[model samples]
Target: MRPTITGLGPLLDQIGADTGMTISTLGVLAAVPLVAWALFSPLAHDLSRRFGQPRVLLWSLVVLLAGTVVRSLPGPVVSLWIGTAVIGIGIAIINVLMPSVVKRDFAGHVPAVTALYTALLAGFGAISSGVVVPISHVELGGDPAGWRIALLVTGGILLPFAIAVWWWAHRGRRAHSRSASQHGRTGIWTDPLAWLVAAYMGLQASMFYMLVTWLAAISMSTGRSEVVAGVDVMVYQLFSLAGSLLLPLVLRGRIERFAPALIPSLAIVGAAGLMLAPGAILVWTPLLGLSSGATLGMSLTLMAQRARDHDAASALSGMSQSVGYVIAAMGPVVFGWLHSLTGGWTASLSLLLAVLVLLTVVGVFAGRDRYVLDSR
Candidate 1:
């Protein structure tokens, strides 16, 4: 995710320089994730039922590696789309299964562990987004081969995970085959709490993806260097990292007591930062990050909090992510389209503010002291 995101600014630059594509044209690269979601979301659950969750996690990375390698291949515009689509499928699988992995493996430590995982994950993403341009500028051999080097870095990062999984499988890890142990079924899709969680997930995801793809550009428009814009992106992500760590601690004793107020307040702060503070972006960026990070961490934690056990967690995870990501997939494209039509960032930023307002209202419902309707 970090690699894909980090590469976006440079990727767009590369495409524009080489092929005369516009930002909108390059943004279409995001469509690959949506297409994969539509194609493979149904398959993820079926595969989980058959091969089991851990195996699904392991194999997804293998496929992800293959996709990354193929993306580096030299070709015309078709290569970018095809490569991205393959990568999207791989990411989708991993995205759906990770929550299950967390529920099963970490058990009672969901909040702390989820925060740690997301922080580390986004931290790397932050680093990647900030550096991809510089790295490409310095290391790329010119022509298409430079893009290949950028792609290779991601593939290289994924290598160790594959090796570790292989090692763990050979050692006969027992957790891979164990079934999720929760009792009672409350058909999650029909539950209102599930939808609330899904909405929270979707809105947060949409906001983050849209900003990541555009924030550097946004800063650049403000007369900052791309490097400074990249650093601003990092500042936002760093705040996210800090918020993840801090919010979990803050919510530990009072998840049920304070969550409703806490979650919406965070979203409100983020919305303010994004929509209302262009002049003070240096200050607002980290504030936005902190708010977003807290909201995101809390949202994931709520999945475990609302579910009765690991089975419920896995099911809710699938439902929320499957639905949430599809919604999220629309964000960048929509924002870009709106930007195109409006001829500037103002209208698009306003639309996002509206989304955040909606997110806050819905997040209050999700963060309430209630379990899934099926659970209790």
Candidate 2:
């Protein structure tokens, strides 16, 4: 569900052409959601408290579907921004609340369920990237509106299941905010480890969004065709899926260990490869995929493990993603502008390499064996 918004990043070129916008303008489409997530993430706890998490999730799906329809509508550039922003807002709510649900429901198997969530997200995201062009051309019978058709069809498939899940979960449930602390069980606002977690999340999210937006185009710049480049993106996701599945076995629920450092370090190495040898995408793609996927799995796991209870999970999740996304919101726009300014890929790729380095350092702090509720 979250990956659907991300999948749109790789289609920026097509969107630009259709909307008669520049690359810089199209970059906004990718970053807009992050910005919205930043703004909306902190509000999740309040809404869930007032209306129940299950019901809130259903409304999120409804708004998400509406955003898709609005984006697919034939209109000027404004519709794209409006629709994308709406989509981002919906995703924000889900992102902030889902961790609490997982922490409460699957408390005994945090890493395993985190892995499952990552796998689903990465798998569908890869499918979205790989199929958009084919679905546009073949599924839509060569219509000029193929991209729009593809978006609608994908949303159509996901919406029903999303609705059913929320509907089932909401049975006999009601809002319960009468006596709960408004700030959740603890105050993570001043915790240094909390800041580290947010930094790790922001940095990793920046790199991930950058790849989703530029991977295919970057590969294509290396003399590969669009289809082949898209396949490379799929291959990356497959490796990511592997990493996600492996993370649970690697550390179980204990994340604050020396072994986890290898995850983001691997991403740093692969990112260096991307800068130096863009042509060998097949080689570096797996490295990035594996490490990035593991990093994501850990991030979600940490959101749960770093909190002692569901209330604290809600607080920490809201804080981590909100601040982190605000930091990440600049990635696509800055990356695209760098490419435009330099007229080459080297500068942009180098910047991402720097981000990966910072991601590794902060991830270590985030992986520490402490909970937000245990702080001073």
User: Which candidate tops lDDT?
Assistant: 2
Best by TM-score: 2
- lDDT for each of the candidates? 0.69, 0.79
lDDT by residue (1-376, candidate 1, tens digit) is: 4465445653455656766777777666755665575457545655676677767767777777777767777767676677778877877777666666677788878888988877876787777767665655563345334556665674447566765866586455443444544231337778888888888887877777777777877787778876678778777788888887876677756565556446546545655765666767887777678777777777788777787666676667667777787778788788778878877788878767777777777866776777775545
What clash count does candidate 1 reach?
Answer: 1
TM-score to true structure, per model? 0.89, 0.94
- Sequence-dependent TM-score of model 2: 0.94
The alpha-carbon root-mean-square deviation between model 1 and the true structure, to one decimal in Å, is 2.9
User: What residue pairs are clashing in model 2?
Assistant: none
Please identify model 1 stretches exceeding 4 Å from their true place: 139-145, 161-170, 174-186, 255-257, 264-267, 270-277, 373-376
